[model samples]
Target chain A: MEFNSRIPIYLQVIDTIKKQLVTGKIPPGNKLPSTRELAVEYNINPNTAARIYKEMELMDICYTKRGLGTFATQSEERVGEMKKDITMEVISQFVNQMEELGYTSDDMVKEIRKRSKR
Target chain B: MKYLQTENLTKKFGSTVAVDGVNVVLEKGKIYGLLGPNGSGKSTFMKMVAGLFHPTSGNMMVQGNKLSILSKGEIAFMPTEAYFYNYMKVRTVGEFHEDFYEDFDTAKYEELIKDMNLDMNMKVSALSSGMAAKLKLAATMARDAKLFMLDEPLNGIDLIARDQIMSAIIKKASEDNIMLLSSHLIDVLENILDEVIFIKEGKIVLSGDAEEIREEKGKSIVDLYKEVFAS
Candidate 1:
């Protein structure tokens, strides 16, 4: 994940891991990118990455097995959780775009159906 | 009336001054981008305005009223870190917002939830970082406060998501409202902000109308930022 100099770096770490989890790039029970590895990958302060992981662990997005590296928390219901969390922010954007394009609910549904076909 | 104003605001951590002598005025119905380098005091400055950290010296007033005295119901602060009950479902967060913020619009929140294609039943703890950031944005934007202070609103999320976040903020902002957004993404904010305020070493380095700053600086706001915040 590329870190923007403006936003706090810990946030970038959180965003990156979130994407990995949602895309199944890091499935449940999967060992996460080590704090050191994440720090190196983003070229950020290691302390910052550790802080992000610690926050995620608190959020129950990941768990530490002790003596072993941190692993993705096993939750069959997580995909729904993530979708709801992301959709709230994304929906407003979608509504704004539809407003810009002058698309009504019917038009939006049709567009979605059309997109789904292919 | 000025939507948000800070009077001689000063914030210090231990002996370190994160913000010093900051007297800023953000007018109603305008978006102000608080720009600065890392640890240059952008977040601290925002925190002070949000009343997260009491100004060690000085004061912040929203709509000419001191924010310190006003209840949390009046001002909505979206910190860079997502603040939600991880154990709660997404729908429950909406209830929490409604309960805390007097101006929170539950209908708007629910509509946004559906529009975003999110499952209201999902637990917050199961969300990814991007999801958390987005959720934070939604929760904050759902409020009908006089002032909205967003610290690094687009700090996370993909380029597409960044555009979405920006669009949401723009759509939600109004003449009766003030949106103070701090982000390192100068390019994204350059066109959106009606005014620009730059901070360096805990002081207001430069601030003025965005267009005037562009005209006076003789460069895009991004270029000016690069020059001002040059490492």
Candidate 2:
């Protein structure tokens, strides 16, 4: 992954996992890559890689199966919640970026609707 | 416990100071980058850690023990120089390491040599600089040491060979071992490093989690390296 220098790396990693979860790229009940494998893939510390799973567990997005491995939550309710969270995240970022460009809320809504209409 | 710790580590040659008052802590399970310009005391610091050169002052601890014979065995130092015998074939170097280091794995060395596409029958002196580096890295990494210090492993390696060497390093890395690599190739090494230590005049000017440093500075490692070395 091409990491952004702006955000914390773990956040970037979380976002990627959340993206996959919401999009069903990694469907429910799927096992995540082992912590060691994840570390190698991202070229990060194993401790940092473990943090990724810990955060995911705290968010109820995945659960550990003892010796088996960590698997994505099979609950549809949590998946729905994750989808809403992702949507809100994108919306806030868009709004904040528009605000940076000196565009007001009304201007943003108008432009967004105009663009969606076409 | 710190995997490696140096308190006021200093090294001098006669009246000239090569390393001075460098204090740094390293932990296992992390890949660290040792960054500095030439003559910034990077090599001197590494040599001190490797036990190749005695420190003029200060103390260093490896695995909770002071620098001693025990620590030396667990620390694999790949020096910048191509030290292989001129008549020794590439495979002969692996044999030499196997006999010298108790932890050296001849099988892994053979695997690495093949993966590196090195001709085992070729004489050491006939190999190119890049191949020689790969051989050095392969030999050093084949050992299951507690610490692996690679000094300029990718110095003159081409792009493709750099990738191969990097993958091998990543594969060899585990939660039980620490790899400290020195390189001027910040862009290539940054992504793989867990932490980055920037040295200037033998002191650590900046060091932190690689990604954390980027977030804190709002610049890539390459940019940070340039900004630190500049001026």
DockQ of each: 0.01, 0.38
| Candidate 2 lDDT, B1-231, residue by residue in tens | 379999999998999888888889989888899998888888889899998899999999886678889888999999999888998998899889999999999888899899899977888989988898899998998999989999988898998788778878888888888999998888778777889999887788999888778877888888999999997
| lDDT accuracy of residue B6 in candidate 2 | 95
Among all windows of 10 consecutive residues in model 1 chain B, the one with the lowest summed lDDT is B65-74
Error of 1 at B73 (Å): 3.0
Error of 2 at B188 (Å): 2.8
Write out fnat for all predictions, comma-separated. 0.00, 0.50
> Which whole-number lDDT from 0 to 100 does residue B118 have in model 2?
94
In model 1, where do residues sit more than 4 Å from their true spots?
A: A1-118
Clashing pairs in 2: none
Q: Which number leads on lDDT? A: 2
Per-residue error for A93 in candidate 2, Å, reads 4.0
